[model samples]
Each structure stands twice: as structure tokens, then as C-alpha cells.
Target: MIEIDSRAFGNKIKNIRNSKHFSLRQVSNQSKDETGVAISPSYWSLVERGKRNIPKPQTLKRIAKGLRVDESDVFRMAGLEAPTEATNLTRITSSEMVSVPIIGEIACGEPITAIENVSGHMLLPNNLVKGGDYFILKCIGKSMEPTIMNDSNVLVRAQPDVENGQIAAVLLDDDTTATLKRIKKTKNSVILMPDNPDFEPIVLNEDKPGRIIGVVKMEMKMF
Candidate 1:
């Protein structure tokens, strides 16, 4: 196991938090907005001070996004080296960004799915999202092709609710599923429609059950 110095990690967290001019409350609030996950300000303060150890990977991703830096950058700040940048044919803006780790791929109604171990990630704007939590995923299949494509990396802002017409990471039943489809509201149901016509739409009884995990705030095409 790679041993990380707790004190050094804390100092690095503090440095990044201060550098971004974000207070403990600000960080907690941003996290709540972005991830729909509640993080106490006092607890966050301890985490920043390195008084807290063993931060979850998802939490790390969120903190990196909130601080406008990459997870590798955060690792480096904590005395670990940053990972090499992934190559993509698509044009990337010169502005700094951080890569959120790809947990896996998800589908709306497929019986089978692809659940890969932490294979790769998608890059996103450092400050565009407010939540201190996020993760990336490579979209597969044509169910949401064209706009999302078969191999596009999508940056998901982890939250429970999503706005209309935005791509989202969604969960159906008990599966860890994700879709690059747009959200639309009907009088009786919520429809998850695809950009392409080859696939059908997913209709949910809004007043009853269903999960719209989060919105896809950013994407990078690789094909």
C-alpha cells in the first residue's frame, strides 16, 4: 500500500482550499449543491487540516473539482506524483482542468452492463461545477449516440435532481447505470430521450420511483 503522510495531505488540502478562497462553509455548500451529498463544514475543516485521514475516492474527486484542480494535482500536493495526461483527438481548452475517475458505464434498461474497475477518466472545468464531489464515465453504445457518442468521456456532477434537456448519470432499479440522455418532463411522466433515434426513450412515473443521479456538465469526444 502507498502510504500517504497524513499531516502533509492535510496541509495540501488546506493550501488548495485557501488558494481557491473557499471557506469551510463555502466548500460544504458547494458540495451539497453539486453532489446532493451533505458534508458538514466543521468536518470539511478537519479534512482540509489533514486531521482527518482515509478520504473516500469520490470525496477526493469532488474536492479536486471544487478546488479547480485535477485529482493528480491534489495527489501531487499531497506529496504524490500526478498521473500522465490521457491523449484525446478532441481539442481541449487551454484553461486548467482535472480528470474525474471513471467508475463505470451505465445503461437505462439493459439486462447486462459493463462494470470495469477504475480504468480511466474524463476531464472537466475546474470551477464550473459547485459540488465538491464528481466522477467520470465513458459512455458506450448508441442508445445515446451523436450527442454523447459511443466512446465519449462524460463528467458527471453527482446530485439527485437534474434539470431538463441536460445529459445525466441515471440509475434504474438497483443497477449502477448511467445515460447520456436529455431529461424532459411530461404531464404524467418524465422521459429520458436519446439524441439518436435508434434507441427508445425511458419513461418514469415522476411522483413514484426512479433516480436521476446527476447532470452531465461536460464531455470530451475520443472517437
Candidate 2:
């Protein structure tokens, strides 16, 4: 929701980009890992020359990271209250970036990042993540629709458990299959509830238990 003086922002971005000898194409590719958003070089060239403005803070953050420049420095050029906003959003000050693997269904029988399971990788801001194993899961099926669109990706923090009523990835079929659901633990069984009312929830009991793959941290469209 931040407004930008596009001309001034463009000059600053151009100067820094030139100093670092980065091509618009290179920056575009580098930025994909940072935000998982595809950047078009043709459009970005216009952005660098004062002809266009960055549409949102997220794109600005990606370009800043791709330039290896501290975002606060760039934010100031746009007259933004970087510190207050970044803190509130858990955005980090450090320029460090972390690459998180994008994996398919995770089952207890297979390694979390098994070569076959890993489809790709996404770069995340270091400060945005806390200590723990992290991975990106591709959303599938319509059970989680409306809340999570099919084919989108969810950032997951690998963990053994999640609180009741929280959305989590669960491994069933004796840890051979995985599914996404909102869990509710009853007195003697666990219910895997879906956001879509059309789909029925699955109930698990002591005889057939479900293992938690991880709780979802954020849902990403990757557009």
C-alpha cells in the first residue's frame, strides 16, 4: 500500500544496478528465488528508467534483495517507515537470503527432501524465518479450496505437531500418503477437516494414526 515517487525511485535503482554491473535479466532471475514471483525483464527495464513504478512492497523487496542492497536503504528513497513496517511484518534488516526446497507430498517413510520429492527451490528472506526445518508444499486438490487455491504453494515449517484447529499437512495410510487439513482432536479420535464443505472430513483413531508433516506458515501463489 506504499506509494512511490517512480522517477526518483527509478534513478536510484538504476544507479545501484549499474554500479553492481547487474543486467536487468540477471536481476529478474535472481529475484525469482527471493520472492518466488516471476519478473519480466522487458517490464523491469521500463521500471529502471523512470517510466514505470513498482506495483507493491513485495516487488520492491525482491528487487532490493536481487540487488544485494539493504531494503531499508531503498525504502527510505520512497519515504517509507521501513523499520516500523518491517518489524510489524517480521521482515529482516539483514540482506541475507535463504533457499527453501519445494517438495511434493511428504511421507514418514521417505526423507523430507528426498530427491524425487523435491520439485524446486524458493529463496526466502532470512529474518522472515525462525530456526527450524522449512520447505514449500504444492497445494493440490480442492479440499482446501477458497482458503488455499489448488496448485498454489504453502510455506511449511517442519514440526512434529500442531495445535488443534490449525491447518497442517498430515501423513496417513501408515505414513505412505499425505493430505492437507485442519485438525481437530476429539476425546478418542482426530478429525482432518477441509475448508470446502463439499468434502467430508477423515477421522483417525488410535489404530490408524496420522503423523504431522508440518504446519503451514504462509500461502503463496507464486505468480
Candidate 3:
């Protein structure tokens, strides 16, 4: 079995949280809401600061869920093998399947779509996502946690627009980065809402430069 250094593991967790812009309190709250586990902000802070040792398997699982990250990654960071469910989901038979391109990361700060972003491909079971053109993107932030999840691979169907309250991948004014958020349209503006309360809603004027790249059809958890 691989051995994980305690301090290194702690740093890893902290980095993941920072990348998602999730505060310790937010992670704790979301974990409790999603998994019925109560992890206090103080305790999580200790773990992140390397003052406390890594928790047990069950506790680690709760932390992973709370952070909207792969539980298996957490397990590995702690020098443990991932659970069967986490390890087995990606193994699919070739029959009745289609290859979906797994694009590079989509930034929440700005939105962009281009051919240079292609990273690799994933074979997905057919009937999972039905649409005109479909691709996959690795979610990079906690803004949509408890719904889309950070680091989760989301299946997107190419479309210019989506109904209100629907989640979509969008490009901001610069169109150099991309973000995934729930669309809320008003008379004068469009609001991108994050499922995590810690994040403030992004309001864009109706006339602002932006476009919906695609609607999220499905999510494939990565561990």
C-alpha cells in the first residue's frame, strides 16, 4: 500500500479547498447537509493546518463529500485504497457506448471554449446523455457543490441557451474561461447562481457580452 505523509496530505486537502474557494465553515455545512456528518470548521482547520492527524475512513469520506471532491482521492492521500464503488464506476464495457471528449478545466472566473482545450476522451454508456453534440468538462470549483461537484466530470450537450433554473456551462465577456452555474434570467440581467451559499450570485446585464455554451446533461463522478 502507498504511504501518505501526514503533513503532505493535510496540504493537499487545503489546496483542494482553496482551489474551490470553499471556506472551512462552508465545507462543514455542506458535509452536514449532504451526508448527515457534522464536521466543525475548527476541526477541519486543524486538519488543514496539519495539527491533527488524518481522520478515519468514514470521517474522510464525509470530508470528501463536503468538499465536493473525489472520495477516492482523499483515501489515496491518506494512503488507503479507494472503495470499490469509487474504483469501479469508470470501468464500462465497450458495447452500447460512445466516446466523449474530456476537455480541459473550465475556469469559474472567465468562460471559454476552444479546440485547444481537448485533453482526452472517456467512453460513456449510451443513453446517458442524448443531444446534438456532447463533451465532458472537469469541474474545478465548489461553486456548484452538492449538485455538480468540484472535479466532477460533467456531461454537456452543446446548445446556445437553456431554460431558466437549468444549469449550463457559460462563457463570460472575455470568453477565455468558462464556468458552470444555474441560469436565472431577469428583465435586465442574467444571474448565475451557485448552489453553495458561500458564493455570491454573478449578475450580468442582459446586454452584457456572454453566451451559453451548453447545458449540463449528466455528471460522472471522478475518484
Candidate 4:
């Protein structure tokens, strides 16, 4: 991570908050991480006054959402490197945007990104997303709220599996059901854990089975 002027970052945040007419408590209460921890009002004040430390990526995202701004723009202000730029492209406002297919229902036996599976396409100006074959897959449930919203289409990088603690697009019931959840692997089983505590984790074993088709690179533009 790059060291940045805390005051400069704080000023940028304060100005945004003021522009939105949001108080410290309002932003703090409106913001929360995926784990459901909100930034405290006291800490928020300290941040605005340049007396506290910079927030993590997740915290910045929540705060930006509370401020009704793009989190990538906040990241740029803080001099933090995240996949906030370029990928935020909705319709390629710039000169370059690669068209990625939007995969609908699973064809089961057919190729993952086959034409039979594509329902639509999304244009994006992203070198990161261009690094691999990508498709848009909708997260069908509320399991990943505060990170990936319910029924939100996510940009997916085509891959067979992912490391532990990474969110993946997984197919269940022989590819008839599609869902998004964080994956955890053990010697005996594959565990699909939900970010929300309101939902229960799914443990797949001999009786229950699933196949990971891809990992979510980012949330696609909601349009």
C-alpha cells in the first residue's frame, strides 16, 4: 500500500460528506462491512479531522456507498490501488471496451461460455477483465449481501476452481441451479459459506455435490 497524506484524504472525504448533507453518524450508521461492522462515529470524526488512520478497501466501499459516490473515485482520491477504475465502465464511455458475454442458464454438458448459454453481452473497458475469458453471471440469492447484492449480475472470470475464502460462481444439482458463495475446502468436503449470518453454510459431500465454474472478478454494472 502507498502512504498518503491523511489530511488530504480526510478533506476529500469531508467535502463529499458535506456535499451529500450527511453527518458523521449518518455515514457511519449507513456504512458497514460485509461482516456487518460499521465505522464508529467517533472514529469517523477522527478520520474527517485527519486524526485517525485510513480505512480498509471494504470500509471505503461502504463509506462511499453511504456518500452516494463511486468507491473507485474515493480510492483514486486516497491513492489506493484497486480494481475501481476502467472496470467501472458501463457502456465504454471511453474509446476501449471489450464486449463480454452474459451467460444465462447452464447448458450442463455444453461448453461454459458457449453461444447456447449466452443471454446477452456487456461492454467494459478493462485490461484486468480482458486478461481472461469473462462472462456475467447473476448472483441468484441474498447470501452475499453487502458485497454482491441479491440477483445482481457479477463479472466472472472463467475458471474451474478458486482458492479458499474466495467467492465463486458454483453450479449445483447437476447444473440446474446456480448460486454465488464463498468457497472453503477441507480434506473431506467443499463448504459454501454465505457472507450474511442470516443464511446457513452449505456443506457438499458425497451425497451433495457441486462444481465451481468461475470466480467473481467484480460486480457488473447494474444496468
Top candidate on TM-score is 4
TM-score of each: 0.46, 0.56, 0.56, 0.64
Model 2 alpha-carbon drift over 4 Å, by segment: 1-95, 105-108
Candidate 3: tens digits of C-alpha lDDT, residues 52-109: 8778888888788778788888999888888876654565667878877777855444
Off by over 4 Å in 3: 1-95, 105-114
Please give the CA lDDT of all the candidate structures: 0.64, 0.75, 0.78, 0.79
Sorted by lDDT (best first), the order is 4, 3, 2, 1
Global lDDT of model 1: 0.64
Candidate 1: worst-modelled 10 consecutive residues by lDDT: 108-117
RMSD of each: 15.0, 12.7, 8.3, 8.2
> Which digits, one per residue and each the tens of the lDDT, describe model 1 over residues 41-126?
78777886678884766566556655656677766555545444553134657576766667654443532222343556556656
Model 3 scores worst on lDDT over the 10 consecutive residues at: 106-115
- Candidate 4 off by > 4 Å: 1-62, 66-95
- How well is each residue in 1-223 modelled by candidate 2, as lDDT tens digits? 3566788788888898899887786676556543357467876788777787654666677777657677777777666756555464654444677888898655457777777678788788876567888888887898976456577788888898899988898788857577889989889988999977799999988888878889987676464
Candidate 1: list runs displaced more than 4 Å.
1-99, 105-117, 120-125, 128-131, 206-209, 221-223
In model 4, what lDDT does residue 50 have?
Answer: 87
* Pairs in clash, predicted candidate 3: 110-177, 110-178, 111-177, 111-178, 112-177, 112-178
The residue pairs found clashing in candidate 1 are 10-50, 62-132, 62-133, 106-178
